[model samples]
Target: MFKMLNQMLNRTLQRVSLFLLSVILMACAGTQSPNQVTVTGGTIEGSLTPQLAVFKGIPFAAPPVGDLRWRPPQPVTPWQGVKQTTDYGNDCMQLPFPSDAAPLGKTPAEDCLYANVWAPKDADGTTPVLVWIYGGGFVNGGSSPEVYDGSKFAQQGVVFVSFNYRLGRFGFFAHPALTDEAQENGDMLGNYAYMDQIAALKWVHNNISSFGGDPDNVTIMGESAGGGSVLAMMQAEQARGLFDRAIIMSGGGRSLFGDRKVSEATQESLSGEQYGLNYAEKHGITGTDAEALAALRALDAETVVDGLNLAAMFNPAQTNKPTWAGGPMQDGELITQTISDALQQGNLADVDVMVGATSMDIGGNPFKDKDALFASFGEYAEQARKVYDPSGQAPFQVVGYAVGQDRTMQEPARYIAEQMTSHGQQAYYYRFGTVAQSSDNPGAPHASDIPFFFDTVAEKYGDALTQQDQAAASAIHQYIVSFAKTGKPVSDNAAQWQVFAPEQSNMLNMTRNGDMQHGTDPWKARLDVVKAAVESSN
Candidate 1:
């Protein structure tokens, strides 16, 4: 009897121990620990915060280094075990700027082709996806900026994503040898940056579903150069059907690949191949095609970047001239034509679009001399002065500011919207004019709407955010969130945002007072004059 009793006691203890171990394992699984998800390359582990399951530094493509430099992005090799994705990847190589004094997380590098994702902790593969592209005139900018945090969007049920791409000389450099090699491979040349973007989108399409995102409903959005990239992607044949919606904030509507202006004249612009030759010659890299390419490839990455003079490349004084030799190229296969030509020909991606610019984009005046400003208009100088400097008493600085804004951003954005609407596609237009209350800001300058749209005013400005600022940010944020989810921008607190139509030309203007109103095109007359002058040029 004693032996039987001991056996029963041992069995009960064993069962109890097993139950406790199972409970412990279950508790650990439910706790705030690292989470795992499998992507194309392999399984990746990310950490969970209160709001989001964050995954960073996941390789979307192999590092574009060594022989891979200047070549199209290649597929990432699969890895063995779960890859830790707790940190942001290297930023694409760029010169440091004052605006970006504080680094996002990691250092910049040539091997920077990774992407990051932010999804709700409880995501179940049915959330909308938003992929952001940063803007730095195609010469600078990265996806690791702190202001671009995706937690807000993730908290609102969005799977937010961002990635790094090649930039500057590395991104757009075109050499005869490279072109020849591409021809040998029967591949497209130039515009490698756009190729990188497409690769990321392809990755998202294939893998986002694993993160509880709806791959079929992807929205591509960007600011400035990023916005321009969005426009370029809309016209890219390779990017078709990759995204269902697009938001182009502060993107211009001019031709990207060629020098064709939105004006009536059709002029030949510098070809990407020719530009590459010029860049190579300027760098004293003279020799046979193979020798020149070898010399370029042998140079240190920092040396190449430091040698570039972006100030001169993007000199606003050089109007109608190519800004930089290494921007989006007109490689026939990838970027066949400019956005202007594509839209007129009705060859753009048949997707819904939201396009707008800040009230004071390209903030400062481009022209210092009043005579030079009027001279640009040629025959329409008198009319231009009358419209731009209506009072004749206004300062030249103010006059120049208006002219720059009208020509560069406002008109181009409106033109894009008009074209999209005319083609029977849904188009929404907005003008973000809400000025921050913290500083004595000069109107809503370029990129001012970013924080507001992301609903990150507090994160960016800290204690400076006023009650009014918060309200405006919330309204704009919800509008964008609604657009990403439902294909239409709706805000519970703001007025109904009307669809853009050529006849109505209605725009949702976020006023400086934090009120949203349906307003007519305030700059129509000025833009008409600017448009006429541009068309008359050359």
Candidate 2:
């Protein structure tokens, strides 16, 4: 009996020793690796793929909650030890639009000022960086969408970074109480959404070098509202020198405040203070005092979101008196002038630019009839009809759609290229005209070029994605990779993309058959008419 007892004790001790040894080994292994990096917050360990080292959910700013709500991004709270960042952080608080092209992968929450990075596994600080900003009309969008993945970028030998910014009212509100607070504290007022973007760019400038990216060689790119952000950054005083190049994707290069202007003192059609007051009154919280501000911040995130999404933004039933500010405005400090103002005044950063729109983009269905639509073009009505509908038999709806596209996106794209070329900067213009094999649309729809740019067509199309789709994605992705690496965009797989010059008016077209064609723009007459109308209106 004594011998059996002694033998049992020995086996138990051996087992305990093995368990401790395994634990020690794991702890040691986790302590150091190429997958681990120290960012502004703290040391974070990421995951490794065959091609890249990916770090996700590294907080770049403090959670915009409590008193920090609606304030510019604050410094990230430092952490103690290595934090695992293999998963995505919560996306910015917003009601997800069901029909969104790039759906959020993470849950939406207010504590969501996080950035993600992807770098080649063998990186040693020589790779160029591409920072992506998403678009959901500035009301919705997150960086966690699968279609926004940066693995392909890392595979192609460039570092990619993306982050979330506050959206909707939480991002752009401006209450009298807040204005008073800003005055006292010397903090910037309104346009918190843009403030967040500038902060994110600052973070990238400071931390990208640690992840094998050249701090000096960075390209800022975005789509739709994100594209507008790219344009804004090119002129915003605070954003200068943060990036050296930009790519604007269907971001309208025009005045955001049309005929009206945003002012803090006067309650104009687009007054930020008036909008804030309206919002406060709607919630039964009135007054411009500390108590009012506290009550506003005390509201729950969902109550704050209040069903605001892209669908609700465009819903015809929204006849109620306006509460929220439409979106980002000329805040004077961050966004000193409108994108169009800056482009026209030659205030843009001296950098190479690539700007374009899809064949079909936002802006369709405004006029009641063909006559009204053509007449809206003013002095150019005859020219518009000749360029848009020489046949006089084309479907009014189709003609209306074409007019809207030209007015809002197509003409603006060409005009931006023209301005850039005139400013003596290299400008590359493209028209995404590729129609998916499974899609019945007449041309590429708005936001369809996102997956192609990221080379995530498989995620966007799934089983419906074809060989042709893959080829187009490859061609487009190569051009982007080339642009991010060098100042110029080039792709051996596709036809050479020529620089846009006023003399030639060259633009690259990703044809409906998933091929690239570079030459003079075919719709020059239509765009010229739209340009004349815009200039006359201005």
Candidate 3:
């Protein structure tokens, strides 16, 4: 009987030990150093800093390499174990700029279909999400720059995301053979970069809730090419309902996908299918059939990029001719029509939009001679000269800069806002005029508003930042955060931002005074003449 009692006591002790061990494990898991979250494909383990939880290099799509080089982004295969997402992935392949000036990561490769996310550590899955698209004229750029760090946004209760897409020739190339093959497979072709973006959006929509983000409340924002991309995605049929709002900075409306009229009229132009055939022929990869595609794909990525002249790709004057190529084709599938055409036809996504440009976005005018520049306006030349070169003594460069700013950035942005507001959609407009504190700095130049918008002034300008700069950044950042959370950009400290209407063209002009105020349209007559000139040309 004593032996039996001792055996029972031993069994009881074992049960107690097992229960205590499970309790210890539960407590330890509650305080684990790194955080783990399961997404669509698999579970991801991310690092936790003092400020935010950062998950980098998470694959949203399979790598576009080898036979998949020019195809639409494919889904990532599911994985079994937890994946450690610690560092950034490779940036999209492109020619390198100076290291100090380069906005890309250390390595750039074709296998670069990854995204990064930043979220508050204590988030409970209801935070608003902001997905950023970087701009390198659609030929370069990635999500790896220091200025693009999302810690600030995360601290303000936002889940920030950035991703890498195919760039340059790899992103936008098209050919007849490829189109034929796509038709056989019941797939659309061209605009692979945009396709990659759509895939990323779908991924985010499916998996963002795991990162404490609300899939229903997403804001898509971009500058320059990225800004244009916002418009593109808004019009893309495949991207419907992916985002609820958009922020476009320095993005052109009519010229977003190249001169649509020109591309359509000029059979041997930069953006159509003929241009693709010409590109293949230029590289001695002849034939308009499957063999040509085999030859084109056989050539390595570097060889394809090496054969093209970088200068011609960037210079509008050069590309205006039939010899050079351009990015973002007007293929009927991905980009059915231009942004202007889409907006006019009421085919855009019905989402709230905030659009703006800096004071001096494109530098001085592109024309060399004053007479030639004004003469392009034909009957409106006299009025243009009076409005743009009012002094008649202002240097051609100064006049050109003013005209270029109006033509390229300011006018296009205002036109988009006008169109949106006219359609009974909420639209907001602003003019970013906050110049950095430096003797060399002119008025806010192209892309200057980026640091301010991202609240990375200190990271970009370091010791040169003034208190006023910091305040401006804070105000702008707060405005964006408010917009992301609520449809309207309402902040306690900021002036009440008015919705843009066709009758009253008021803008929230951001100046160095650390105060944002409403102002009337400054270049009404100039933009009117500019718009007339563009319409007449078309």
TM-score of 2: 0.93
Candidate with the greatest lDDT versus the true structure: 2
Residue pairs with colliding backbones in model 1 are 125-212
Best model number under TM-score: 2
Score residue 76 of candidate 1 by CA lDDT: 99
TM-scores of all predicted structures: 0.88, 0.93, 0.89
lDDT of 2 by residue, 128-190 (tens): 999999999888999999999999999999999999989998888888899889889888877
Q: Model 3, stretches more than 4 Å misplaced? A: 1-34, 99-102, 259-271, 307-312, 315-324, 363-368, 512-514, 536-538
**Shift of residue 469 alpha carbon in model 3, Å:** 2.0
Q: With candidate 1 superimposed using the best TM-score fit, by how many Å does residue 337's alpha carbon deviate from the native?
A: 1.0
On residues 1-538, what C-alpha lDDT tens digit does candidate 3 reach at each position? 9999999999999999999998789656753344777777888888988878899999999989877878899889889877898889998887654432226654878889999999998777889999999887767688898888888889999899999888878887777788887888776677889999999999999999988899999999999888999899999989999999999998888766754321344443544556667777767987768888888888877776653333435444443224234677777777877788888888899999999998778634557699988988888899899888888899988887788788888889999998888777899999888876653555677777887888998888788888888888888998888898887887668888999876677889887555788767676778888888888887
Which model, 2 or 3, shows the larger lDDT?
A: 2
Off by over 4 Å in 1: 1-34, 100-104, 260-271, 278-284, 309-324, 363-372, 378-382, 535-538
